[model samples]
Target chain A: MRGAAQSLKYLLLAAALAYPLMPFRDVYVLHVLVLIMVYMVLAMGLNILPGFCGLLDLGFVGFYGIGAYTAGLLTIHYNMSFWLIVPLAVLNGALFGVLLGAPTLRLVGDYFAIVTFGFSELVVLFLTNEIWLTRGPLGIPGIAPISLDVTWLATLLGVDERWRYAFRGEVPYYYLAMVMVALVFLVMTRVEDSRLGRAWLAIREDPMAAASCGVNLFAYKVIAFAVSTGIGALAGAFLARWTLFISPDMFKFWESFLVLCMVVLGGLGNIRGALVGSAILIALGEVLRVALPKLGLPAETRFLAYGLIMVVIMRFRPHGLFTQVAESTMQSSLIKDLRARIAARRTA
Target chain B: MLEQQLVNGFTLGLIYALIAVGYTMVYGVIELINFAHGEIYMLGAFLTLSFISMGLPLPLAVLLAMLAAAAIGVLLDIIAYRPLREAPRLAALITAIGMSIFLQNLAMIIWGSRPMPFPKQALPAFFSEPALTFSDVTISWMQIIIYAVALLLMVGLNLIITRTRVGTAMRALAQNQTAASLMGINVNRVISFTFALGSAMGAMAGIMVSMYYNTMYPTMGYLAGVKAFAAAVLGGIGSVPGAMLGGVVLGIAETLGAGYVSSPYRDGVAYAVMILVIIFRPSGLLGRAVTEKA
Candidate 1:
């Protein structure tokens, strides 16, 4: 049965990979799909800090912005290769994450959230005001697309000579994004099922109890933040290559909120749910951008709609759509075990 | 030169303190940051502008604006909060963020995105004119009014918090919710009253800020809200006097930083100060340290 289930999962994954290619393959649609995949990576990254570790991170976009700018600057200024710049961006992002997390990890609840929010604002302000380095509001343009040397391999395989792969086109990036997303998803799933994942969950449920049980709260929290930030940076590197642009406005607090909404809407701590959430949110935002004008609604009404959707979702389904079963099971078992342990200790 | 910046900072600080009081008071009583209070402040400014444009007397316009702002605050609690009384703190926090965004966008849709000028005729003739001056430094009569009014409001709030029966009940609730309930305190009523009081003060701040800046815009509340939130945090989240002190300190920091350093870097200085304070003195200047019960 387990082997059958495993095969079924692989089959579903294959179908998903094949489904996007079967359409008419317009570049616009393909670009949206690529964007969705990128955001899925980001949402998964954010989930590590906020969802699993129960840290409220309102400035997640700050690291993402850093990653994009780093990649953009390196490729545009130093003429670095895309493969080389991507890892550098991730490293830069992880270093920043550690810097931010180390000092603030001791704070509890809303204080930590506020500090993170402030950090995010500070980053954007820095990017905007540091004209010499960031070019202020003019933004960096002419970012190069990723180039792969797969042509020789294709020739070796005797593939069709008519196949021309342009770096600017969506086809090459789409496959690249798919591979990254799959890798991130696999790694996150492994981490979630590992000892580290349990430590994170324990800290999230009750930090004091977790600490009493020998889990290092501060270490795990900081690690979660660092890992999540590193992943966000990777997404940023791709985003710079895909759009060929990097601007401070793109890393606004609202972008962070959107990612948070995706995590919450899709069901926190669930990797597949984060993917679904990102797709739905990105699609809805695009649809609303187009539909509001046709409906004779003003542009600002879109924000109103966004706020309403979040409020409604939070009101009705606080645990989100996908994580209901796991939450309930965990809550019940936790309570039962606590009761039993306490009674046994009292009797002893 | 330093005195001039100090005066400017103090005036701005007073306005911030007025708004910060609302945030601190609500938080003190309920432990929930009332995010919509900033929107209430925005509504007050817009309502004042609307009434003055319609030729209402300035005082009457201000009064009507305050009432409207207070009503919106109460309505927010009724619709968004009352149902979620039993919900977790995170849920309430998310809802507050949602309400804040909703109010901002609703204002954008209703009032349009353009900045509206405050009606010149609404100001008293003497107050409209510039007052004291020291060489190039100039102080306006309007600044005096703002300082006086803010001080008066703070005193009035202090009286209510210390002297009134409702004030005692609020203190009781804040100290211990279950014990307060056991003591026959009407928790819901006191919470509602706290919201009303906080909203009124925030509205007053909004009115003063609009008159001071001579402009009102739909999205003006966001930056001010963040600054005020920073002030509240600086003073200690649940302390009233801390909010006032924090606001003044922030105001002074920004003003002096702008005068001595680049204007573009003034906000950066203020936030940097905030981060430093949080790292070194998390309880704030005057706030008592709190221990989590776990």
Candidate 2:
């Protein structure tokens, strides 16, 4: 059964990879898939907090807005390459993360949540009021699409034509978003097995006990905040480039709540659950958007459904669809090898 | 001009205090943020509108609406929050947010998404007229009514908390739930009463604001709730008197900040104050220090 389940997973992944190239591919469907990927990255980023560190961060979208506006402003003002803008945006996000986290991390659970919320609202206020920088309520438009400038290689080969390939269609963005999701997933799974991840888990389980065990709780939490917000910014950078227009409304508090909902619905502390949660909720939102109008209700009322899903899930499945956290660490080859060696020794 | 701002700020401050008291009292007893409290306030306005349209007098409509708001609050505690009492705090908080969204959207679907004017026909003819004029400052009759109603409800609330048996039980529960229950305080009943009282005060605030502004919408609660929660935090969570003082201070600051500083960043003032208070003085001005429990 396990072998079959593993095969099914790989088969689905293969199909997903090939779907965009298929003759029957729909533009609308491709757009939704890409949108889902953006949220997937966000869910993984947010999973680091409530899932791993047991800190409920309510202002995660603040970092997302920061990253997006950074990318948008840079592209419009300097016409910088996406490659250069990405690192800059991520660093900017991490900087803000540390700045906000250092002073506020000392607060416990509920207090910490409220402060994060206040910070996000302030972010929105800044975005809306700073007309000189963010373009205020009108939003920044005409951000250049990401392009591959491989002209350097062509010049080395003495080619006549330029080798620039600017993204013009959804197909290129679809693949790029998939690559982004994969990279984020890889980093999350790897970190979950690292010492840093374990330190976070210890902090979440018991701060006092973890402190007695010599773990620097404050330092680890700040690190988690930096990493999490950095990833959130990365996703935001992708969003700005993909949509080609960035607005303050796009990063409202509701967006943070929606992403948090995705993380919780998938199960806190479960990385794969985050991916599943994003896919499910985003797909559900699309369906509601289309079906609500047919049912004589406005599409915005879809939040009502999202809210119901959260309450029902919290009541019936609080741990989410999956229960085991750090499940990847136990399945590592090294751990499996140790198990085998121990069994062999006992048998001898 | 400063005096005018002060008078306007004072009226706004009184409403915030009424709402802030609800947040503080609930937090004191249950340690939950009760995000849906703002939705209750919105519902109060809508319910009053509905009652008034049904041919009920203005006073009767307001009274019925507050009662309904109180019942909804009790039901909210029973249905959504009661089961999560022993669960993790994160779960309860998420559920509270979910309920808030659900209630807000439900109100939208019922009332339509447009802003509705509070029935002007139901209001007294003189509410829009100025009642007092001193130098350059003017106080409207609506402002006077708001002051009177807010003061009355707050005083009534204070009497309940200080002089009643249930009030003592609530304080006992806030200090230590297990001990209070051990003393046969009927923990859940006091909690329900607390929710009922707070929701009624919040309802009155909503009603007055809708009357004052002559408009209300489904999303109005989101901003008000955040500002009031900020007020609650500024007063120090779990402290009623502290919440009142914090609300007044925040309202005056916000009004004066809007008047003198950038009007575009008026809403930002509450958020900035909340974050600063939480970071620098987590205990707030009137509350005890908050330390993480083992």
Candidate 3:
């Protein structure tokens, strides 16, 4: 019954994915969809660390800014193409992860969380105050749009140059984000199925026990941080190119907190849950953006909604709307069934 | 210039100490970081403003505001925290964050976001007059009162914890809740009392801060709260004297950093010092070495 329900859920999800890819495109709808995809990618990066590894990173957006600025700066100063800057941004992000993860080695729980929060605020301050490098609050504008050079393909196929296009339109960016999301989802799933993933879960469940079992806690934690950073940076780089502008104001503690909310709202330790949470919240934001102003409400109400939702979700469903592994449920039921069987045998 | 800055820093440190004591006492008892403590401070300031605006006497207004903040702090515990007692630590932490955000937004909704000049008339006539003047350094009656009142509160808090029966109950609960409860101490009541006491102190700090800065806003809590949390950590998270010591040290460091280093990064300087302290001494300066129970 559970398997059938899961398959049905997947079938509907597949249809939903296909609906957006249809030839007919609404710019406004596609814009929202693109944002959802972007947030999903970012949330998935965070999902891996806090969800799988159980390390709460309050400064995930610092790596994100590092990635965006890496791509953004190279585009502005070096005239490097978006394609070329992607790998560089990811490397910088991973390096930052190592720098941050190392200090957090001895830390645990709330202490680690506060340190990360401080680090995030420091990052924004650095970006804002360092006017010489980042153009300060003025922001970098007119970043060259990413383009696919298909002229060679056009010549070979005897087709027109119309086949070549820059990734500026909403539909193309949507496809770009979808491809990235698929890649991250695939990698996350494989990693989650691997030994490292199990180790993280073990650590999350009981750090002492995991350490007793010979899992090098520090190394595994760093790997999780680095991987999350790399993926998050990729999303940031994409955001920079897609938006064609960069500013310190765009990356705030609120953004990091919102992403954390997404991970928590979706089931932590579950990949699909992050997607669901991100989609729903981003959709809600887009709707609120249009409607709240019309109702003559202050703009700060959005944060109020986020905070209220977090409180409600946590109070009612502590594990979140979605939950962790099915194996736990199966194991508990199996134990119950075995206990019953033993009782029956004794009676006989 | 140096003297003036030092004077300002010293006064600010005392204020931060007042807020830090709340964090330490609550943490010592419940081990929960009350993120909304700052918002409680914000509320106290706003409430005091409202009371003063309504023609209430200053002393009565301040007392009522503190009580109201205590009540709201209790409400926060009941709403955002009580249900998740046995849940994961992360849930409580998230709830605290949510509560912080909620209170900030609630304040914004209640009092518009613009910074308002603190009502000078709310203070007594003597507070409006300068009490002392040194070469290049001037101190007002209000500053003197802030020190005197804050010191009195701290001393009173110390006395209550060390000398009184409720203080003994709090100490017992902090050491071991289950054992304390077994010994006839109402654990829930003790916890609620700890929150109330801490929040009352925080409210008083808020009034002091609004007077010190002479400006009050809805979002004022975020920075002050974080700084006070840092103070609590630096002195020793659960140690009362540590919070006091840490707040002074942090306030001085921040003020010095602003004076000597870049003013824009003065806030970051506090965090840098905090991160360094955390790395070198995780138990904090005054915190005892805790052996992690497996």
Candidate 4:
């Protein structure tokens, strides 16, 4: 029965993947799908930090901006290869994550949040004002698109001449983005069940108790930060290659809030939640962007609707749509265990 | 020129300080960043415009704006914040951000996105005229009135906080919610009252800046709100006086940076200073160091 159910799930997944590439698929819809994939990559990264680790970071877009800018600069100035810039961007993100997280990890709760906010604001401000480096507010234009560099392999495999040239079309890029998204999604699921993830959840549940039980709180927290930022950086780099222009304005703190909203709205600490969350939010954005103008509503209504959605969701479902079960169990266990332990200690 | 910039900075900083106080106080009690506070300030400004345009006296308009904002603050807590008080702090934070976005876009819808010039003629002539003229630094009566009103309110707040029974209860609640409740303090009432007071101050700051600058807009709250929150953190998250000092410091720093370095970099300077302060002195200027209880 379990085998049959698992195969059923795989069949559904296969159908979902195949539907997008059907011959009748619209290019605009395809574009939206790719964008959703990009956001899924980002939200998956964020799933590790605030979802599992319980550290609320408001500066996520800062790391994203850094990755995009690094890619843009290297492509613009040094003419670096896309493959090379991807690793470089990831390493840069990890370095910056450590640099930022090392000192601020000790801050508890809201202060940590504010500091992260300040850091994002500072990054955007610097990016906007430093004309010499970032070209200031005008934004960097004519960014190079990614090349597959797979032509040699195709020719070696003796494919037909028509099928063996350099890659082209948004369709290929969509698959490329999907591959990365799948890789990130796989890594996130694995991490959620890994010992490192357990360590993170342990620190989140009770720092002092976790510490007494031999959890290296700062070390694990910092690692979460680095890994999370690295994933975001990877998304940003890939996204920059897809788009031909990059700008300081594109990386506003609002992007961070948007992704964070997805993580929470989907379900904090759930891997599957990240995928569901990003899809709904990104689709909502795309629909509103297209629909509001048709309905003669103001462009600003798009954002107003976003705000209303959040309020309504929080009012109706504070634990988030995807978090109905595990949330209660997790909370009850932690609080109940603590209270029980204290009671037993007093009785003893 | 330097003196003039300093004056400008103080005026800006005082307004930010008022908003910061709202952030600091609410944070002290509930530990949510209260992202909606800036929007409260924006509402206060817009409410003042509505009331004054309806032929109410300026003083009455300001008072009504404050009261309405205070009520809104209370409502915000009761609706968005109160239920999530015992839930994870992250839930509260997200709700606050949501509320802020809702309020901002609501403002934009209610009032068009364009900048509206405040009706300077509705004020007495004295308010429009110069209060005192110095070399290249003439201070207007409006500036003086703003300063005087802010000072008066701050002093009044200090007295209420330090001397009144309500203030004592508030401080106790801030220290320990359960302990204060155990001691017979009504935690709910204290939290509600704190929100009312903080939001009142923020509304007044919004009104004053609107009149002082002679312009208002829905989006004004975004940057001002961010700066004010930064001020609160820079001064120390939960410290009231620290909000004031942080506000003034940020104001002067931005003004001077704009005057000397580059005009566009003013906002950057404030954030840079904020990050440095958070990095170097997480305790803030006057705040006591926080130790993790867990």
Top model number, DockQ: 2
The DockQ of predicted model 2 stands at: 0.75
Model 3 DockQ, alpha carbons vs. true complex: 0.63
lDDT of 3 by residue, B1-294 (tens): 888888888888998999999888988887888888999999989999999999998898999999999999888888888888787777788889888998998888778888887788776668757789987789988889888998999999999999999999999988988899999998888888888999999999999888877889998998899899999989988899999999988888889889988987888976786677777787788987644433
**Model 1, range A126-245, lDDT digits (tens) per residue?**
999999999988899998888765666778899855444458678778889999998998888778767788789788778899999999999998889899999989999999988999
Model 1 lDDT at residue A11: 100
Classify candidate 3 by CAPRI docking class: medium
Please give, for residues A1-348, the per-residue lDDT of candidate 4 as tens digits: 767857986997786578667988777887888889899999989878888888888899888988899898998998888889999999898889899999988878776777778888888988998999999999889887877566666688887453323335578778888899889877876776667877888887788888899999999999999998898899889878887688888889789988888887777787667788899988888888789778665566677776766776766776578764333223335544764697699699
Clashing pairs in 1: none
Off by over 4 Å in 1: A1-16, A19-23, A150-166, A324-348
Clash counts for the predictions, in order: 0, 0, 0, 0
Clashes of 1: 0
Pick the winner on lDDT between candidates 2 and 4.
2
Against the native chain B, each candidate's TM-score is 0.95, 0.99, 0.97, 0.97
- Proportion of the native interface contacts kept in model 3: 0.46
**Pairs clashing within candidate 2:** none
What lDDT tens digits, residue by residue, belong to model 2 across residues A90-151? 99999999999999998889988988898988999999999999999899999999999999
RMSD (Cα, Å) of model 1: 4.2
Q: Give the better candidate number (1 or 2) by DockQ.
A: 2
Better of 2 and 3 by TM-score: 2
Model 2 TM-score is 0.97
What are the iRMS values of all candidates? 1.7, 0.9, 1.5, 1.8
